[model samples]
Target chain A: MTVVDIPPPLPVRDRTALHERAPGALSPMLTRLAEERATGVLVREHGTLHLAEGRVVHAESPLAPGLDVLLTARGTLDAAAWPWTDDIPAATHRLLVAGLLPRGALELCRLGALYDAGYFALAPSSTPGRFRYGTTAAAGPPGAVRPLRAVPVTALERETLRRRELLHRIWPDPSADGAPLIRADPVAPPPVTPRQRAVLDRVDGVRTAPQIARELGRPAFHTLVDVRRLAAAGLLVPRNTVPPPPPLPPVTDPDIALLKRLRDALEAL
Target chain B: MPGIDECLLEAMRLPGARGAALVDWTSGLALGTVGEAPGGDHETTAAEAAELARLAAEHGAFSTADDTEVTPPVEDLIVSNRDSYHLLRFVVTSFDATVFLHLWLAREDGNLALARIRLGEMAERLVLG
Candidate 1:
């Protein structure tokens, strides 16, 4: 009998992730901000993150739903009772005085939305991210509700990495993350959980995962999970690799055609 | 469910309660925390607990008929050791709330049955935006 030793391809655990993939290493600007204790907004092409004293106060992205959508979807915020703007602090104070909303609940919602969108905001990008110090009117009406305790930038980055790792484990293909989903023609479709079925029902071949998440008021990452699983089950049109564009029609060079015809005519002459 | 802080504070009032937190299982993010953490770190404890919660919530073996679109399949889970116990109860809300209340209590002094009952009530009343 021979004893053979084999090594795993890659250790996909969180601990290994910490050492192998440095948190926020992809975005050096955020680390620099934390060192300076800078208070301002970090803007990228895809999204923006608000920071106060180097901690993440708020974050928003076009790719993920905002706090208002999540709040409305949960049916907790009464627009009349709690009219809110960017100033989370101010809006929260008003709601507290009105005795309509709990500060803790609002904070938690903001936190969830913060991380949800923050994940997209901190994604690796082609362009350099810009940072502006000092609060702007856009930061919130001077009294916008900020999270009671700001989350460390590093922590948010770490969590974002963890989410990406989890999604990759579920399905390695990255196409479904952005592609408009269409059902696959499986001989027999696999069954999905009630929650996943809801996700599948919204597969209109026009809406991507993020759009579906906004419509459903679910966290975008969860929606991605369902999409990946659905893809693995042959429920979604699996684009294993990015499909190449169709070939262009042959160009008609009239001069060459006329030249060849002229040469033939001369030879006949 | 009760707002994050309030629910955690309520759990702390229970006998032998050491620490409590409201965590989102899917994202493994701790919404809020109170008292002392089992591992002396709230964030790490929440993430670790979320792992167990996700397992119970997603697996087919522990799934019950009571499971519905909005309701989580497993009501709660209990893990006990020599000197402590961890109680996790899933919360149901209008939206797909993938959150649970985690309570770490002293083994000898904690009332397991009472904590479980109260944790369930807290989870039921928990309100999230």
Candidate 2:
């Protein structure tokens, strides 16, 4: 006789208590999920991370290009892989069955894009993250494309930290990240490389680093590096917003309850 | 035809292979790794190796004449210090060619010539899916 063991369900009450403690709790939230060996989608302000049994299966962010964009941009994907990509599993299945991509192309490309988005998804922000428990990320088999590789949360966090340090080492100031850059020092040329030139040419005082990355079909972190380098070279204008997020005072809001009371009294009058 | 683990294991079959890892040079993420790591940690080694790989692949001086294709500019980089030989061979894929195979071997026991040739072959056939 064969006995199949079922995984335990996610504890609902414990997670409900976590919501009140959030608003800047992505790290702790991910740690809790890892401890639970839970399966679900972690939805955040900047992106979403799909977790499967304590591992990060997929991460998506607006700052990073999607797998479709990366594939279509390369022009190497078959026509079938393009439209059918609406559903990841089906698209991967077709790509594999059709022998369109090599054995690991889909997985590699997805992993590349996954790291890009994962970095942004794990960025320290003031917004809270919400984890909805489910099995969407756990449906894939060993070699399925939907869940290419199950990355340990510890590994993901470490990689993300390394990337952050790399970016910091490249250019300390992060104003170029979200701010439009201008050609600040045009008189003296800094002798930019061809790749840096490609990134610089996109700088029109309108597009930010992420926008430039999207335009060039490159990772946003790479663009951030280039932007920071350009800024360091005294070529691009830096935004005034350079300081990191500081502790904020209590939010001030109008007395809506008193206003409603006054209105009710006026109506009675 | 070999997956990440199988390919790394094949690299380990080399005479003096100490460790091997498949790293994405662009994002500095190790797709898979086997055997020992250079600094006793694969993540740090992968990051440092990626910095070197990116230094080669990103510059115009090292770029190949062929600009039409999406392949990386440099093929592989061989770095040898006091005792060991580090080989980083770029893996050209359908989407992007930012991935590379990193093999660590002792200079005395390792065969650089044979390892480079075998690593090149492994990079060509490595399947990550």
Off by more than 4 A, model 2: A1-26, A83-86, A139-147, A238-269, B60-70, B127-129
The TM-score of candidate 1 is 0.77
Q: How much is the lDDT of residue A122 in candidate 2?
A: 93
Weakest 10 consecutive residues, lDDT, candidate 1 chain A? A136-145
The alpha-carbon lDDT assigned to residue A198 of candidate 2 equals 76
Interface RMSD of 1: 3.7
Write candidate 2's Cα lDDT for A1-269 as tens digits. 99888979976666555646643344888988988998888988788888888888788898987777677765767444575545554455556555666656666776777778888999987889999998764535445343355788887777888778777887788777888777776787768866578788988867788888777666677677778888888888755545558897654546866787789999999
* lDDT measured at residue A229 in model 1 versus the true structure, 0 to 100: 87
Write candidate 2's Cα lDDT for B25-128 as tens digits. 76678988899998899988998899899888777778877753356768899999899999999988765437899999998999999999999888877743
In order, what fnat does every candidate score? 0.35, 0.40
For residues A74-183, write the lDDT of model 1, one tens digit per residue.
Answer: 56665455465766545554664554655555556667878888888977788999998976232334343432556888888888887888788889887898888988
